[model samples]
Target: MHQDPTENIVEILLSKSTVKQKAYRNVCRAFKELEQEAQLLIDVISAKTTERDQDIKLSVEPVSDQEFHIRIAGDLLVFVLHTNIISLPEDYEYNKSNYVADQPLRKYLGQINVYNFMADSFEFNRLNDPGYLLARLLINSENYFIVEGERQIGFMFKSISAKPLDKVDLDILIKLIISQAADNDLVVPPFPNIRKITVREKLEKTQSLGAGNKIGFQMSYQNETKS
Candidate 1:
């Protein structure tokens, strides 16, 4: 019988041995596959939603987080997530500037519910929409982040998951997390910047993007040793 890889993952974590490394590699491999699936999904969904672009009239600068802040040419749109969620820095401001009093980053980043999005949508829509599915890169991976076009948008995980402790905390929680064994299916490698490769590896392999925009992140993997 095929056991859940997550069980193997937890055991590997619990056991300090070479098997753990192999398990970690397996986890990364799994995330990489999921990431690809997510991209395909974006392409498919975007094609369907393009026809409704009458209200979408903002410059797409291909900004960080794969998000682009829209001026709407000439109109006022009080922005919020698909949910009755409040605004984040990325949700508003024309550029990347903190908005919540002195908090700087206090944006709400909700998951991109594909099921809900297909049913409901913001009147004005474009590539860099204000939902999870719109902004996150490596969505199914641990390195996943809430992509935002505007700095006005705060971190999204804070509300759905919990509040950020600091920049460090902000960074950690933003990406994919392992709440349980199944979540390991999406957990990214090295957990953080720590890695089998160095920062240079990241710069070389990864396309760096700004605060709210997204750049692709290819999770790394080690080969499982054959017994």
Candidate 2:
């Protein structure tokens, strides 16, 4: 009853490939829905600002098939859908959860990364400025999703068994992301880090300054709320 090695390899490949395909499709669908939701949120915010005669710049721009950018005031949130599917590490918390344990195939997921950057970085063409990863959205073949992020974003959407991702969920997520980004303000770099700069650095202020919301601070997930 020994299985042929070639046949076994082919069978495993076929099964995993199918799972990857499904996960990719689900991520793509979620990305499209997110783009639409983001635009809707921007419109609502814009309307309110207009009502109050306030100038709050807000817009959503699709950068590519896999990426989009949402500008809310001084912060820019970039959403990028990864083309590849991935499996959770063995020790990852999701792997230990009953959701994935019940169906091991659920471990395979596609990812969409959310990054926060200072709008001035792109506006002023500061190529060396850094962008912080605010959250990662993981979607499985079944569209069951989880968000790994800072603060409320990390804890609020931990459940994978609740339901498939939807417009309402996206709206909530977009608001949380914008709130987190806006709450974290840019701070000056420590004296030691910027005290000793070369003459060349003085000439290239934009690149050498390395501006970021948490430029000289600890950016660990556990330390996010502390700041």
Residues 40-147 of candidate 2: C-alpha lDDT, one tens digit per residue: 888988898888767677899999999999998888899999998998778766777777777788889999998888888889777777888888888998887877
Structural similarity to truth (TM-score) of each candidate: 0.22, 0.86
Model 2 C-alpha lDDT versus the unseen true structure: 0.80
How far is each candidate from the true structure, as Cα RMSD in Å? 21.4, 4.6
User: For candidate 1, lDDT tens digit of each residue in 65-152?
Assistant: 3122222223111212232222333433311332223332223223221111210123333323323222322111122223332121
**How does each model score on lDDT?**
0.29, 0.80
**How big is the positional error of residue 185 in model 2, measured in Å on the Cα after superposition?**
0.9
Q: Residue 182's C-alpha lDDT in candidate 2?
A: 72
Model 1 TM-score relative to the real fold: 0.22
- What ranges in model 1 sit over 4 Å off? 1-15, 54-227
For lDDT, the strongest prediction is 2
